[model samples]
Target: MCGIAGKTGIPVENIQPITDSLHHRGPEGSGYYADNTLQLFHTRLAIQDLSDAGAQPMQDESKRYVLIYNGEIYNHTALRNKLPEISFRSHSDTETLLHLLIRYGTDILEELNGIFAFAFYDRGEQQLILARDRFGVKPLYFRDELPNAFSFASELKTLRLLSSSPLSVRTESMLECLMLQYNLTETSGFREIERLGPGKFITIDMRSQRRQTVSWARPLYTRQYTVQTEADWIDQLDTALQQSMQRQLLSDKPVSFFLSGGVDSSLLAGLTKRLYPGRQLDAYSVKAGAAFVQEGFADDYAHAVSFAQQIQCRLHTVNAQPDLIHDLDRIIYALEELQADPACFFVSDIAARAKDAGQDVLIGGTGADDLFSGYRRHQALYYYNALDNIPAGLRKAGGALLKMLPAGKVRRLQKLLRLSLAPPNERMLQSFLWINRSEAMNLFSADLREQLTLDTIDTYCAGLLAAIPEEHDPLNQMLQLETHCFLAAHNLNYLDKIGMAHGVEIRVPYLDTELAKLSALLPPQLKMKGSETKYLLKKVASRYVPEHIIKRPKTGFGAPIRSWLQEDAAFRENLRERVMQVCSQWPEYFDRQQVERFYNDTINNRTDGAYTLFALAAIESWLRQFTAN
Candidate 1:
């Protein structure tokens, strides 16, 4: 709920500018700690204590340790009760963390449950320790130079301001942005900054300037189940989800839910309605313009309205229009880099409207799909698991042959073949794979291709695979991978950026550490029964939502980018010029003629490469914006 920035071995004057860039993140208060070798600044949003006592970079009573922390510790009250001997200066979680670190050292992270990105400067130890939440819900980016200095912040833009070096394009990162629509790891479109991976901790030694990165918590895919019945699993999920919701609802400001007509949002709204009846909860949904160019891609706000009506809550529908263009530049600026994805635009608009209405805390059902096997990819996983019976050699041969077709045709054939040959887990992974070696190579310059490899992607996927116990069931392994990797990295990161960009705090009940741990122990059959995705979730949701709503098909929060690029000449022209200019110097990597064909087809309503094209344009825009600045 705040922005933190600092520099080690840098002048205080140099660090101040970086901190100033993040004022929007913490408009309530700002503070800085400076010495000859280090300067730390914190922008406080003042969620928990709303007092001067909660101001950070707060020091321990002994004044030996100072900390800049961003996030909430839900169990602060419980932790406080256990340590009555410690006098708390404020009712903020920041003080609670300061006390815990003093008492337990860095090990205090394991005892807490919440999303966070924090830097604890141990003046006593002459070391700085940076840690992110177990789920990566909050972001922390840092740029390091060996033997002397480093800068860390909540967003890359703040870190960019601290960097004195010229910004260069990281070719691999650029390709990732263009082809995958997002970078796979910490490497941003800019070569100078890197994100701190989730569940990771980095320690820096001021004297040596050496840094070491390690994971304090990793996903442990344990399948030790004692519950024997589906009903038992449902009961456990219900209890966990409700408790999680109650904990996340602990905010002084009015809380609202981002109600998409989907099952995830509907279920959250239903739960909130039941928990606080007659509270007049505010529910927000995006309804696209009726005559908008991409009318067919509009969200079904009727479903969202009906659910809100059923709960007797006030529903606010925001119509997305072309005139919203003025907000696009600001949104891109806030994002620090243009995403070019229309979804970013929509979410930003929603958050802006919600913030304008004076609502601070926003709740969304972001982690449900990853937790309960709710995506089409999960269904593909079930099919793949059934196909494990097929001969490996034959399956490989068939797969290779299928790849000869056009990318779309090849994808369909491969999916069909995977359904007939692999396990559900493998299918899920394949379904979510954004960039292949060939695609990456095609998108990246030769020099960049030589320097970069898909090793990070492989290692990330491998870590998930290794987490599964050898004896665990296949379905459980798939769920474990989705929860640990896909949910933590992709879905959670998306929600965090979009929500925080508008100063809205979004909490995911499904990703509650305790709830996820407990749910992991449920029998796989209960999670996915036959072809039904999120079987257990539906059963638990039945208690809150109507049966009809519970049975509705899953529709994701995506924009009609395909239709927009295909028919909107102005949008297409902007996208095409950006893409062409950025990639013009490296013709070997990208076929300009093919790119033109792709854009023309898209604009003429002949192709759905809109997402891909938009991603490319985003990377181009990011390159131009960051480098020029």
Candidate 2:
């Protein structure tokens, strides 16, 4: 993994500053290639081949096509078989991809697998291609506003470095991120920067100044895997996961594991042990304190110990209670663009530990929840169906009773309530968004609210849902949106940016192209059977993990938003200070009296604005660090 930057139709005095700024991502090597047509800068991390031959801004033997790539290509060796005609010097995947594009052109993206973001330039054709992996496991951002000028980078910070002027926040995107935990569209936090959607590739004709974007891949419900049986589904998932683990472990260095001891993380470490029983793997986890357990988080240290003992792997634990708020500023700045996920801190902490332990790569489990219908939103679909069958009066009575239930079940039922009130297109937000539309819009000043169109948000989501035909299952349709909006935009983006921030590369086995395809084919009934979420996954986990781990109540892998706001005195003070600061800075865009009122209401438990408060504080910090007048 590395950082990349390039520009077209603009004159540059130097690419040194841009390359230097991204040194954290790729501290090993740096290079640049420029001409009248294009300028490309690359900082390399040297994952595959440690020799000079692995250096990027690499070109074909003929030198007609040049490439600067980030990410590992697991199938590069296999792909090289197809390009036997080229006399190659380096064994690096970068060389493999360069030759593949030379032979097959842009049409090869659909067949390409692995997590990557890259720029491939064809000097002879005067065309440039910028592409991201199928699920956007790797991120790419570009600026195409200027008539004949174009720039692209691996992160938003590098794009800012290339800008001729200070960047302003994209108002709609900023508010959307605050309302939802992450941005739903390609629009970045800044007006001039735009995120490239997952599974997408854009071709730019440097000569004509015309660009065309195409979705070469997407979460497909092709029903291509025709295996049909409870046992068949279990076997298929088990086999695909093992195969994915094998491909993801392809690296020149030893790869470690991130073990929460939940079934997902345990299964990954468990399978790694199964794959190579003779070798012991290194696994890292957060030891959330008793104080954290009071906030309703899992005391994952015991579980981590259990799984490590079960697998005979070396476990390294990081104490979470001490550095929780201490790491906030560094993590917020590392995230660059604002993402309110508390997992960012946890993962960055894990990455730092992984780096110190001499491991350059860490295997993560992120996509299984979205792919296997493992969230409260998925559980809500079952409730939605049950509510649909009940009479209106009965449903109303049941809704009233749900309030009396225990706290844990109430959390799941709350999602059911959110879906019940929303339109079908917006139902996917049950898990993604923290506030309702009216509340979110009300948080904005009237002038800004008037400029924002509510229809566009639903329309974009409805379009993603439309990808799966109407005749298909409703849960699959919602899962498609969850993958595109939540998984791609939120989960995968942070994993890449924050992991790279510490010089640690995260490889997610579940997001492997073949494994994702297998998941797309598994029927919804297997994914969530009745109130159970990830039913098939648990069954697959049983073959490799302990029963205690498989059956644990799902404590999510995110920060405890409610408790952090209500119980933690230090964190609460930090939040209030930042919120007040932003209110003062953008008084024209936000009503200070209203925001303060909502925040106070949230702390007193009179309102559900903990998430909103946390996001606003995150935005305040990001604005202070990344934005300029």
| Most lDDT-accurate candidate | 2
Candidate 1 error regions (>4 Å): 14-16, 289-298, 322-330, 337-340, 385-414, 417-428, 434-436, 445-456, 467-486, 585-591, 597-608
Output the TM-score of candidate 2. Answer: 0.95
Model 2, position 3, has a per-residue lDDT of: 92
Clashing pairs in 1: 381-424, 384-422, 384-423, 385-423, 385-424, 566-602, 566-603
Question: Which residue pairs in candidate 2 have backbone atoms (N, alpha carbon, C) closer than 3 angstroms, thus clashing?
Answer: none
lDDT of 2 by residue, 43-100 (tens): 9888898899989899877788899999988988888889878888988889889989
What C-alpha lDDT do the candidate models reach, one value each?
0.71, 0.81
The TM-score leader among the candidates is 2
User: Worst ten-residue run, lDDT, model 2?
Assistant: 403-412
